[model samples]
Target: MACVAPSSRASPRRFRLTSTAMMESAPTTRAAITAARARSILRAVSGNLDVPGGEPLGYADPIGKILSFNKLEMNEALPPAQRAKQLGADEYPFFGYPGWERNDAANRRLPHDYMHPPWAGQTCVGHARAVLNAMRAGRPYPVKAAISVASNPLLSLADVRKTYEALSSLDLYVVAEYYLTPSAALADYVFPICTTVETTELWHGTDFCVACPSGIQPLYERRNTYDFWRGLAVRLGQKEHWPWENVEQVWDYCLAPVGLTFQKLVEQNGIFGRREYKRYEKLGFGTPSGKVEIRSSIFEALGCAPLPVYREMVLSPQGDPEIYRQYPLVLITGSRFMPMYHSEWRQIQAAREKRPDPLVTLHPETATKLGLKEGDWTRVSTPKGAIRMRLHISDMVDPRMADADHGWWFPERKEAELFDVFESNANILCPDDSELCSPEIGSWPHTALLCRVEKE
Candidate 1:
């Protein structure tokens, strides 16, 4: 493995993993793996020492194990009836242990699902579309306030129109963000938050951990997320719950029970404890059967399909052939890009230059049929809404398919109307209807949709 800083002005310093023979092809191969997939693979492989490659060596990660173990223990600790009352517990009993007691009397009292305040508890597993719908309809009860973290729902959520209405209806909306994002611009109060570069991070895996110190002091009035939350807790008269005065103190508490301190851990680089492979052989997996279940018992108990299966999407060409004739292209939204994160850093000259405009990548044939030249401004439309993007005619996508970017807003433009978020926003074209979501989490189809491209 070798780290090579790219010569290109747009590319950041990146690490290259290579075998002795494939050094030349390493960069291209690595680039093919999307950032999201790479992260997903890392998460899946973390501490999985049971792989066939070698014997797993190390102690069980006390710090990491305890973090998850605490959640499981507390979940099991919840009172049976109280746990069942949790929204979505009835439908998604695997959400908590008490959910196993489906016949509980208290579970019968509460509705199978809540249309209002849509599952607002420790088990924050509610559908975004459902919650937003409740807020707009004001049925059962009204939702009057919302606190947004580093999220820009207006530009990032499916059905931008509904999100806009729900946010606009809020009596109080607070956003903590690094920039005046399109969502933040509509906030009643927006607090400046420190960036990762200005904030320390405690990076931990299942068996290894590292403490990253902030490289530089926070610029201007920016503060870390902990400080922001702590300050709010104080104002809300819940200061007792937040005893830590600073981020370091919070870190100390986290490490103290593990027989380590932030200072000590930093000195030692990190806690790389012993490895115990095939842990299920002894302690058993954290499942109902105490082993891997090919068919999830939890899902079965909750009346959900025990096995994964594909279902036809409502907005897809296959599902609605009538719409397919109008919108000929298969639209896949939000493919990951290297330079910028979701709807962020577009204002930076360096990053913006790498992708100066929002782009719709399509097959060269599709672009020609649509009368689009390379880099030509074009309108992409679905039944829900439309957005404009520059065309990047490429053979990477199928002849009848296109991939559009997400989370776009012109930071340099007027902030009065959320930087004109609807202009090139991908979510505007997405549907958040109940029929369009999954039965489990109400996950809307963002990747696959029917869209038409027209030269602007």
Candidate 2:
């Protein structure tokens, strides 16, 4: 089904009209009616009883499964290893070079290896190339490693910590920062970077669903990323290697590849350069077959499934029904709010006041049954660790579900300490073994978890 917007300012509404009939109707009047009908249609669709509160329709159903399975079968029909080799050669011509292609090549080498710390694993040869380039240039490390031990992956913070600790053990000097835990305390140097609003840039991304220019100045003299990078480049004696002299130059370069000039983009404020911005269009998908393959022969060559299968995650609430009975509530941790990115906003007084520390949200019915009250501090624990947070009883959560706002650091406490050292981090609760990861993608199950909450 296709939806068309009638007016710019009107709230978006959806209408179910026969495609043939809708096309035959008067354009202007039909648009107005469609806009009005969208509201009513949306209301009717949402009124269905099976729809969970705050959850859109068909969420739990196997929508992606159906699509992926079909693609998988089609790809499996191709000769083994041919598809992988073909895909590797095409789509990303620069895979062997020092650009996005190299990144893709690295990612492809370990498509199922997502369990590593952020940008830590050396997946591709390109990463090695970049590392070598930096080393040869006498450049201070091109990558800064930051660890938020409080809300690492739900699989195993210890494993991540061990891996990073091993990496840090190497002579590499990494710039580090910790949100709520002192994981980054091992770094040679630490610099505090401000929140998004606290800084300014010529934001030119289609993520906000709007093609508008955002012009705002930095709230404070805290160094912006571009300024920092430029300053560092100068310090490294490689100023000329960076074009455009300043951020404006880099911004211009980004737009220069396309027909748009920097001055024109700035003048337009933010032009809707492209109407159809498919977010996942470039997922290493350009095959001669020109189809999204769920079953990749590449994975088959690697003795894996190309299909997107939902393997039961280890230590997850779903994996152990018995654990569900004990814990009762499925916990979703580390989701961010608009005003904060992880734990960055905690330092801002206004933002801190608005959202103080971590909050445990539970269904009101569950809260009542457990003899818990809103605003009461409660402890949530797993086999690995536990932490305490203020409660927010609401129906917004499922009766059998609870969530803890992540990325809070108590400055008064030890830099990285939260709760008790042995029983604090959310990751401590998650099992570190490989069983918690997706066998196919190596993606960790961060969303699904079983936990019990008690009044502290």
Candidate 3:
């Protein structure tokens, strides 16, 4: 090596060493070298090149897109009010009034009236408000006696009847049911109305996957729910009342500020309007500050918790050991299936086939312990009451838990013969205590209960 200045660089000397005659003669070494060189060449090309298989591809499922579009079209046509009514009827049809010929002595024997005289002590939020207004004006509780009944999500006619009985003193009762109680039963006017699907509804569709429109014709006789209220207002002679003539007009009024028109929507057969799929990219949220508030300031301002907190549920199985001893398994009620909406699908033959009768599902171990088999008639009882259903032993359910498919009542069948339970109503088994209502959302406590089952 020559001693050269650092700046005056010289090309590096190449060194080559020839293998010994013995090594060169080895075919295995030559083959290994050849394979190594081939792999190195492949790695270099693959590293720098964008191959077809490695590239990202974008393709939409065509069938899914078509189904989505059809759903949107149906939603746009029906509206929300109609949808809600349909859902209610679809889940539970009012088979209360059979033809006059069928109302013979045999049917009359069942318990038609289950209402108790209205109590003087009970009061609800609505009743309290009325009382306060009366006190302010120096008058007695106006509009006759007030009745406070439990108004919970997924209510059944049996629940309505129970509430009516609890508040028997009242001239009028307010409860949100799919259709008006028949004129024969209710003294007041029956209001047949629409559901969420039949009205102008605005929701955060992104929360539930697709913000697409859904529409379907009302399967049974129905009317716009808002119109019922509007009609009531008109009858009451309220001068500055609801001005809308039809459901479309109501939609126009609601969406005017957002620059949406019902006519345009109808013309387009429903719009799956542009939406920001990625929530974070749209600037935090539509809140005061453009940041996710782990603690909701809005709720705090309204004297509510900033964060979600759980308080022990009233009448919960965890608190009642006696209930568990009598009813060994906990019963969870009310889960949605595709065919039914809450309690409404009984009217549709096709949907009814999906769940012909109410099923009480239990784990295999629990069934074995109880000496019960699938399709065995079992009586499930709570502290309040009990109902008989066909048992379905399944591993899908927990060993300690059971499920009674909610909303199954065939009024056409004699009450005594319907099920071993009285009235054949599930609500009879649920606690009637109003305290079971959710504190935050004002929903009734439907699930979380202890019950026992006996093979019938």
Candidate 4:
């Protein structure tokens, strides 16, 4: 049987309907190819070409607007030399803003008077891996101070030992979070941030926009991110830059270009733009090619492979046969759960009740061989480290593969010590070696790695 989901091929009519929808929505050659592949799966399921007649669907072109408004107007409007100074611009030319000026500009006015940060030829010396390196060496310049917002680098980042050492060595570490995460516990100061539930938000999904109104006022000493930043700006003698005291003032400013306020948008429910497909036919893709680049011109210019490829993991059995003998199972991490978002929501009793503990899913056959049964406490280990989790023996995974949920920490544990974040965090198993990353992007192998599981 195909790996395609059952819902994707539930009925012949449904298959044809979705195929037509996909075709209508596909705006580029790349998208068309993806749509075709999806349709091919449906064709395989239906076993005939007789299925017909589904309405052509169209979405409210939000991405096209956002690209034109935010990127083209606000970002690209900056001086070319200034844009060139954005971090990693020299090393990763594809991600640089200087090249993006060639793209089409948006016609819509912006709501707020937003200004790009004047980076002024400053290098992006503070990327994730680079920051860790700075903390380790203190070479180019001593990075004595650090601020973390809605992040838990120690649990989320690869090489827990290195992260711990780097964080421990920092002279000033401050974190803003709802809970005291492992990374937060190491901080010199931990500020209480208001939960998303207490704040208003505007969601831009690229096809449509929704204005969400705040439900409850912030209680206690809790403050929104903007308030925190604005307060900090005042103390840092940058108060002139932050004119807006609250989210309402900021939102109103942002809505000014469209003549809509946060309150007005909330009254109107939401706004959407007209869907115009084949936009490339008129304005062309925002690329040097003026078309969808099958092979990236940027990559080619950088002397890297222009086309994308799928290669076996560097530490996989196929990649390293010697290591495969000792570590057999294919470990996959970063799988998500609906109740929890990444590393958050663990503190909620209801959410925690739904998923009482961290789990590693394994095939029943694999479990039996390793002397593990359903709900058995097991230790999942890699060459880097090990974490204990309950075995959830199911046929959901292949016999040779194990899938574990990431962002594991106990809210019930002592908050003073960050609730034992290291006990079952999946990132502890990943490595951050340069050689182990992608040739172009430097992405760590978070999902695919070699491992073994045994009864703990």
Query: RMSD to native for every prediction?
Result: 10.1, 14.2, 24.1, 7.2
| Superposition error at 3 for model 1 (Å) | 43
Q: Which portions of model 4 show Cα errors greater than 4 Å?
A: 1-126, 415-417
Pitting candidate 2 against candidate 4, the one with the higher lDDT is 4
Enumerate residue pairs that collide in model 1: 58-274, 58-275, 59-274, 59-275
The number of the candidate with the highest TM-score is 1
Superposing every Cα of model 4 onto the true structure, what RMSD results? 7.2
Error of 3 at 191 (Å): 3.3
**Residue 414 Cα positional deviation in candidate 3, in Å, after optimal superposition:** 7.9
lDDT of 4 at 231: 93
* lDDT accuracy of residue 220 in candidate 1: 90
The number of residue pairs in model 3 that clash at the backbone is 35
Q: Report the C-alpha displacement of residue 158, candidate 2, in angstroms.
A: 7.6
lDDT, candidate 1, 335-415, per-residue tens: 888698988898899998898899999898888887788989999999999999998988988787889998888988874
lDDT of 3 at 91: 14
Q: What is the descending TM-score order?
A: 1, 4, 2, 3
Question: Positional deviation of 230 in candidate 4, in angstroms?
Answer: 2.3
Model 2 worst lDDT window (10 residues)? 61-70
lDDT of prediction 3: 0.44
